[model samples]
Target: MRCYVVGGAVRDRLLGLPVSDHDWVVVGATVDDMLSRGFRAVGKDFPVFLHPRTHEEYALARTERKTGHGYKGFAFHASPDVTLEEDLARRDLTINAIAEDEHGSLVDPYGGQRDIAARVFRHVSPAFAEDPVRILRLARFAARFSDFVVAPETMALMRQMVDAGEVDHLVAERVWQEISRGLMSERPSRMIEVLRECGALARLLPEVDALFGVPQPAKYHPEVDTGAHLGLVLDAAARRGESLPVRFAALVHDLGKGETPEHILPHHYGHEGRGVALAEAVCERLRVPAECREVGVMTTREHGIVHQAMELRPATMAKLFARCDVLRRPERFEQMLAACACDFYGRPGYDMRDYPQIERLRVGMRAYVGVDAGAIARVLEDKSKIPQAVAEARAAAVADALRAA
Candidate 1:
């Protein structure tokens, strides 16, 4: 049996990147051969095992044939006869198809190293069209390697796949997985652009797709198009090194503006409430995690209020903090504020502009977040007065912050 260090570990090593995980492809090896050698079986769909010592994944070299539609519709053939070149041919990108042997010999059957030198993302073979998830993978790779350009032929093939209705069959979980990774990439806007260009954005994220041509007030948004503004915000979030939840909130914070009636052209008066429902729909459809979804929803609903922090009355500011449940999840509240800050400075000329409203809200929340409503209730005979008394104290504290500011 011959084992080679293959896939990501080899690719990243060739590119001088830090290798996080290693995968091995065992050629001329059978299931029993692996089992007798102390490898533990772990793969459900194919022949994959874990090394008894290192616990790294070892997949048997195999070839596949398209049997149906979507990513999962495939019949696999694995045997001692399967060649290393055959297994590499089945990979999506040429740059990822390279492998290395134990003697430090590089296997470059598909010209992966040449493409890497040219900074091109090219497909390995015609079999690339068989899996719809490759489109998302390619986009994510584009985001991670921001300097690499997709080959024109590869882009044409992706367009053909989209036109053939293959992308529509992709499952929600895979879509979310790829999109979330793309969002956290070095240049997330490139992922959105690639998806939009291939028409997958409209199929998987229609709410976000609708924002492209929608107009916004030119004064507030120098970019004018709501979709363009979202891209800017997402890039800003990346530049800020913001967390995933904050990045996601920046991506969805302007969805309500997409639904604004044409009569209101420049002004999105009530977009926040409309945005809340759309954000919830997006979160539900993608099956986003609870922490991420909660911040997204809160940012969608209260970002406008947070934007006008300097103008809101102390009582209103206190109520907004209460509505957001900032006392319980202070970190999430900070994330929400960061998302709002991404919105404020994401525009063309406003990239470096200051939004002091964030610090004001932070200071104001710190002042009253410790107030105890239950403790105040004991001093008042009327139970309803307790809420009022706490509100008053919080408001007074916020008012002091406002005055200090």
Candidate 2:
């Protein structure tokens, strides 16, 4: 059986990035042949196996035919006669269609190497429209590789796909996967622009799309509209390469602003709370992970907590930390602060001078609520007597610190 490394592993290696996983395409081999060769047969619908030695995935050369609708309704053909080139050609993107021989010889039947060199993302074939998830993948690729632009023909195909209602065929899980990856990328804001151009954003996140032309009060948002302000925060958060939940927090932190009442002096009095509910709805709709949903909700609900903390007494600081112990990690807490900061600073007409006050508030909170596990535990144990619990918890925490020191 002849096998060659295919898809992302080869593409990532060519890009000089760390390849975490490898997928092999086995030509001239059947599922039984792989099983006989010590590979573990695993796939239920397709001929896929895990290599006995490397534990890498080895998918038998196969072709798919659409049987019904969406990604799930696909019929696959796997035979010994299938070639690696055939399998590669079936991929969505040109850059991902390249394969590598066992000797590391490059395979570029579709000029994928040239496209990679040109820093362009192109469709391998006009058949890209067959799978609607490719549209989301294209947007995500744009976000991940900011230097690479989608080829014009590919963009045209994407628009056609959307126009044909192919996007409606995608499952929520696949859509969320691409979106989460884009949000975690270095140019998530750019992804929104790309999605908008392709009409994918309107289908996936109409809540966000609704903000595009909605005008915020000029006093607070002078740079552009609400959409532009949100884009700025997304761009800033992407630059930071924060964790998935944190990045999501940043991406959707101000989603409630669309519902904010407009007036002479516009203000979203409880937008943070509104945003929490919206974010939860988004998570439910997208079927995101529970932890991610929790973090997103927390970030949105408490996006303004840092500002409120600034005007509080020491007791308030103690109480606030006790209440939000879920934000124990310094990085996580900083990410929350960054989400808040980006929301405030990236607004259209925000006054940069006001940041000093915010920074002062952040610094005070950090200093006052230095990690006190005992305080958190006491607060958790005795919610009835908060003051006494805080005193005991503080003393216990100090003793523990001294012991550690």
Candidate 3:
């Protein structure tokens, strides 16, 4: 049996990148062959095993045939006859199809090394169209390797796949998984650009797709186009090394503006209220985790108010703090604020300007936290009045702090 290091580990190593995990392809090996060697069976659909010592994944060299829709519609054929070249041919990208043998001899049957040197993303074969998830993975790779451009043929093939309605069959979980990873990349906007270019954005995220042509007030958003503004926000979040929840919040924060009335023409008044529902809908549709959903929804609803932090009255600040449940969930509240900061910093001539609004809100939060709400509740004669009394005390404290500041 021949074992070779295949896929990302080889690709990353060839590119002088840090390799974290290694995937091995065992050619001319059967399940029994692996089992007898002390390897543990782990793969559900095909023949995959874990090394008894290193615990790394070892998948038997296999070939597949398209049997149905999406990524799940495939029939695998693994046997001692399967060649290393055949297994590499099934990979999505040429750059990922390279393999290395135990003697460190490199295998480049598909010109993966050439494509890597050229910084181009090319599909392995015509079989690339069989899996819809490849499009998302290509986009994510663009995000990570921001300098690489998709090959014209590959882009055309992906467009054809989208036109054929293949992308529509992708499972929501896979979509979320790929998109969330793309959002956290160093240049997340590249992922969005690739998706929009291939027409997958409209199919997967029509709300975000609509924002590309939408107009925004040029004074506040020097970028002028809401779609362009969204890209900037995502990149800004990435530049700041923000978390997944913060990045996700940055993604859907402006979706409400896409639904703005055309007569208003660049003025998105009341878009926040509209945005809350749209953001909530996206979170639900994607099955986004609770932390990400809460931050996204709250950022959508309160970012506009947050932008006007310096001008809001003490009562308004207190109400905003209470509504966001900042005291109970400080970390999430901070993530929402980080999302808002990205929105403000994403525009031209504003990217480096001071964001005093964040500090203003921080001052208010400190005052609100300083208020002894429990003490107020303890002294209240009527239990029902406790909430109102605590709110009054918090507001008064905020007012004093603001006045002092």
Which is the leading candidate under lDDT? 3
TM-score of each model, in listed order: 0.96, 0.81, 0.98
- Candidate 2 residues lying further than 4 Å off, grouped into runs, are 217-222, 262-269, 308-335, 344-405
Better of 1 and 3 by TM-score: 3
Give the alpha carbon lDDT tens digit for every residue of 146-263 in model 3.
9999999999999999999999999989999999999989999999999999999999988899899898988899899999999999999999999999999999999999999999
lDDT of 3: 0.94
lDDT value for model 2: 0.76
* Full ranking by lDDT: 3, 1, 2
Worst 10 residues of 2 by lDDT: 396-405
Write down the TM-score for model 2.
Answer: 0.81
lDDT of every predicted structure (CA atoms): 0.91, 0.76, 0.94
lDDT of 2 by residue, 1-405 (tens): 888888888888899999999998899987778888899988999988998889999999988887776777788899998888888878999899988888989888999999989999999987688888888888988888889988999889889888888888888899889999998888888789889989888887877886787666677667558788888888766655567777788767777876776662256678787777778888988998876776677677777766664455545544544555624554455566666766676665553446543455445445445555465666475666765655555545434433343
Least well predicted 10-residue stretch by lDDT in candidate 3: 277-286
- Per-residue lDDT of model 1, residues 1-405, tens digit only: 999998889888888999989999999999999999999999988999999999999999999999999999999999999999999999999999999999989998999999999999999999999999999999999889989999999999999999999988888898889999999999899898888988888888889999999988898888999899998899999999999999999988989988999898888999999999999999999999888899999999999999999888888999998998888888889999999999998899996578999988888898878677678888899887777798898899888877886
In the order shown, what is each candidate's alpha-carbon RMSD?
1.4, 5.5, 1.0
